[model samples]
Target: MAAIATDTHPYGRVSRLFHWGMAALFAWQFVTVGARVLLPDGALDDFLWPTHKPLGALLMLLVVLRLVWALVDRTRRPPSLNLAAHLGHLALYALMVAVPLVALMRQYGSGRAFSPFGIPLMSGFEGEIEWMTAIGGIFHGLLGWVLLALVVGHVGMAILHRRLSDENVLARMAPHAGQSR
Candidate 1:
């Protein structure tokens, strides 16, 4: 497919879309969180909680999409790196998927049969275990900071590789030529 990055590899359109769209969603995560953390909890809390819950659930959906895309799409592989860097990528994906899921699970497992967005998941293992909520809750918020750090590192590396080293690291997953800025 001409949409592919090159002959042997390239991220699929849906993969690219999910990646970028999730970036916007993740940005909302940061904003929603800052709104909660910085602002005093009150009437605003209830309003923001609903918004945050849905945004988080959307993140879970996007992460699931990315996982599926990764499984199907043969993305262009980056140049060789040390074991640590490779492991870091693995860790990044793990955190990316788990972070949103843990948060969603905490909410649903804590008791919300349907997604706050209105789409009913209809499959949460609710009432299976009370500890799920406590653990998920702690990890959800804690790992959010970890996810943020990992993302920052991921972006920093991409920029460094692309701009400083003049590599095509980012263009691999970016929109097709002539489509984006």
Candidate 2:
């Protein structure tokens, strides 16, 4: 086995920046969505929901950029755990890109008002796809759970690699200097 220490298989600076920034946005989304569903109306919550739609749009764009990066620089995955693990990772990436899209589609199809940075979208198609939006809402919920499960497994594997095995799993993702390991 190789030592995937804090310095091993260094992700490019763009990759690292996008990786962490996207992660923070994703966490924010989970909180935003959860609050929208679970909390009653309030000034704070009302203000927060608007952020969700735009942030989701930003997430979709970032997904495209991340895909391009992944293709151009096929990351040196810290040695495969197994075929299942690889497949699981593939699935997780697929859904992260897919779920938000369905939600965006729902916004368009349901005639719901949304703005990506206050620029309205889908106005031309309002009242055009009510049924599609209805279906999208259901699909969005399903995708959310799927994303959650995949994240749980990923986090668990990272913990196992660090605490049980001798691997430096978490460190591999921490901030690093240029080259001195």
- TM-score of structure candidate 1: 0.76
TM-score to true structure, per model: 0.76, 0.82
Model 2, range 83-176, lDDT digits (tens) per residue?
A: 9768987887898888888988887787767768868765654365877788777998899878978887887986676556646455555544
What shift in Å separates residue 79 of candidate 1 from its native position after superposition? Answer: 6.1
Question: Residue 176 in candidate 2 has what lDDT?
Answer: 40
Q: Write the per-residue lDDT of candidate 1 for residues 1-181, one digit (tens) a residue.
A: 1222222244566767887898888887877787788875766665665677778877777787787777676444433345866788788789888887787667666665654567777555536556778879789988989988998998888666655543445665663431332
Give the top-scoring candidate (TM-score): 2
Compute the lDDT of residue 153 as modeled in candidate 1: 91
User: Candidate 1: global Cα-lDDT?
Assistant: 0.69
Pairs of residues clashing in candidate 1:
none
Cα RMSD of all models vs. native, in order, equals 5.1, 3.5
